[model samples]
Target chain A: MSNTDLEDDLRGTFDRAAASVPMATDLTGRATTDARRAQRRTWMISAAAAVAVASIAAATFGLSGGRSTPVQLPVAGGNAPASTSAVETEPSVETVSGTWRPVQMAGLKALSAERPEDPVLVFRPDGTWTGSDGCNGLQGTYNIGQRGEFTAKAGMQRLIGCDNVPHTGVLQSAKRIAVDASTLEFYGADGRELARYARAR
Target chain B: MEFEEYVSARGQDLVRLGFTVSGDYQRAEDLAQIALMQAFRSWRKVRKADDPHLYVRRILVNAYLSMTRRRSFTESPSAEIDPPHPVPDPATDIVNSDDLWRALAELSARERVVLVLRYYQDLDDRTIADMLGIKPSSVRSTASRALATLRKARQSHHVS
Candidate 1:
């Protein structure tokens, strides 16, 4: 057969092959799985970022715990022009290394990784910390009391990559945790925490 | 358009083209999935182009080439394939299907891809070159070599 004819036969052969192959249920199973995969990827990327930002703030200023820099942070969708992220930003605390205790957070399943689970929580001596919350990595300010409650204040995260979960919810929850954990009694800003610890250990 | 909708519309055609190019059903599926995900990530930008589908095809060919290079010296899974056109046992119609599958799997990844794009996707050499980010000369040379190889394979199968 001529080459053109051979190409035609090859095409025919492939068509027949596709027809013979057992097809996945297009209505539910295969389609749903792909969607799930997409959502998971999105969530994974976002959570990693949020935790990074929240942790960075905690690491940078919370180590000092003396006083954080008070700066104007740009409010979202507030008729701001140019440099929204830079617009109304809060000031940071002075950099200092202290005996920072690592907050142990459990239940982070490392997806899309072969080995070595990512940091769910990390503590630096300068009283700084960073880690992911399952899906996102956060960076922010943290304050630990000699008593047990802690606060993660002034946090930000970047949302990128493919993940298969609701990003908005994850980010909001992380922020709320930081804001609420402001007391030794484990009470957040509104004073509501089920756990408390001393700063030393 | 929604990602799901786009996938559904182009899914079958993509698989077919992928199979033709990759010369293996399993590898074709992988190419399609990767291409689909990559396209989704940049859908906002790619979907606006004159031919979003072309974007995916380019990614497939480029991706397939990279994959082949990564495993250059290794034996491919399709090494044991039987040519598709001739059924050894017409008594079992399944043999027809198996032969066809074997034929596709036997083609080299490059030849398979060029043929698939040329015949199944109905893309000209220039377009295929653009999609794959290769010089048109390379596409022409590859296509010529692939056509000759495919013809020889088909003839040998027919004689045997």
Candidate 2:
């Protein structure tokens, strides 16, 4: 009947509800294991990215009209090498604008379609993107700056329940993209590689 | 304190809060895990804050809100329909408590959240607003509407 009565009733009801539900089991154990796995994934990604970049640089150096000196490529936590006359390559609009298939996602090294369908992503030149997480349909808009800075905003998505569906978490976290002739790599805001995709055949 | 120690101390409370907000134990556990994982990822930064527990609370609330919003966009229309309300006997305190629980569940997610944060967590409208990313006035209005709904539900139970 009164405000105090209402507040008391609410508190009583909530307290009862809270008491009825049991505390989550193994929450700490699960959380710690997940955290450690995530940490390992980050380290692996960093190492893979460094190797990928080195290989790309070495290939580019060999194709640079046979330059006499090899320009040292960047390594993880290593000092910057001396600059050379060979022009550094960057992914252009043509390289980035197309459909891609996930080679790796969600911190997993390989994503095999458990079902008949595989996840696909379409990054349109008009700054819009659409994809299937192998089950649910997802659409979003994206932006690409002059220096390969990238960002994506998710739009409508279906709520179909399916297992092993590739998550968009990595794409959402991507801050930059690097595209070579066949593969594209997405880097997080912290400059760590998040996911890698290959051109769809 | 270390992250594992913090989890041992306050993890149950976070999960309980999640259950209160979501009204589903499985989802509550999922929400709590997501928040805890996020907190674990940034434990260093979170621990340095004035109240690291508060930071985790904010994350849990935000995650619950985000999940609800996404569900709203894609949830089937048939799922939103509530069952017919049953008349409660004012003579029975047990019946009255059941009515109260029903009334609480009838409230919208945002309304329930406002009440849960206000009554359950004893947070002010300003703090709730900050957590929900809404204006303080909006928080007040939401709470006002929620309380009004609860009162009306109680009054109807007594009338019948």
Candidate 3:
């Protein structure tokens, strides 16, 4: 069909489909509990939100627990392709060198439970990080600079959303252990350190 | 605004919108009622927002998206409609109310939402996107695609 024809058809279709479905009985009455008992005065928007809000509230319970922790909404981040980067001999920390350990940080376990779909990150030496956050599973660059401490300033981070500050307590604890103690400690989100030890000799 | 008066004026329009979006009157009514309650609870703050109506719309839109969780959100048929006016010319009618309901049913939940917001509520892309917590671009794209589907449905109805 021609463009003009398509446009006309589109408008026609919108009007018919939109208008035909029966409007809710006493919609403003039903949609909202809002009503003014005052004496006669005109011009008010009644039960305005009812027809407009649908399924969003039905699933509110699922979101309530998740809201306790900042769960990143999904954006389709994925695992990095296996390459020389995956299985190469580089002095830098890129490939997974050490054995995997339980990320005893309950901050994430708590966060992940809320949004199992969000992505998580585990930093590696050779400029990369990986893991499934609450939303997506992903691995990306880890630029750690020793001399400039730019990477220190830039910092390691996972991308779950927060109002402002997030993972504030845990990351600080983890960084202090990484730098001063030359040690690693596993901690639950409750702030109980689960395990502690010096770097593997 | 006093809650009672508010209900009388905008109640019908809200119901129309709910029916338009969900294609089920019962579900629409429940949704509308819940939206109103929530609005009432927050009306003090809502009244202060840049467009209080827009704020309420956001709440309603959010409520609709969360419908699956509500025990009352069933897929029953529409409640009967006694049109405000008597029947008019048939040729001009083209598709009757029942025909329109079926077409709306065929749309995905998201499509139904976009179309309802676009025409029924008379909201623009920016407003719709804000309501859905999606980008404005997604609103435009969804509306265009949904309208295309509606047109196809209408055409098929005509041909048949």
Maximum-lDDT candidate: 2
Worst 10 residues of 1 chain A by lDDT: A178-187
Which candidate would rank higher by lDDT, 1 or 3?
1
lDDT of 1 by residue, B1-160 (tens): 6667777787666665556566566666777776776566556655887888887777678778768777354534652234443545553434533444455555676766776677666789898777766788888888788666656655576588
lDDT of 2 by residue, B41-154 (tens): 668767987988988998898888778787453321211112334554443554565567778777888998889999999999998998888999999999989999999999
For model 2, the chain A TM-score is: 0.53
Candidates by TM-score, descending order: 2, 1, 3
On the 0 to 100 scale, the lDDT of residue B43 in model 2 is: 80
DockQ of 2: 0.39
lDDT of each: 0.49, 0.70, 0.47
What tens digits encode model 3's per-residue C-alpha lDDT throughout A1-201? Answer: 444554454345446544555544554544343433210111111112211121222234245543333222111122421111123222223222232323333322333244544323355543344544344444433232221111111224456553212222322222112211133332222223322323222
Task: Say which prediction, candidate 2 or candidate 3, comes out ahead on DockQ.
Answer: 2
True contacts kept of each: 0.18, 0.64, 0.38
Give a tens-digit lDDT track for model 2, residues A1-201: 987898888887777777777757788888878867866765565455445553544455456643434323322223642222132235444556788888754335337747445688887753468878877887875655556656566777777765544446655566567666667777654454556787784
How high is the lDDT of residue A51 in model 3? Answer: 15
Q: Which candidate is the best by DockQ?
A: 2
**RMSD (Å) of each candidate, 1 decimal:** 14.5, 11.1, 18.0
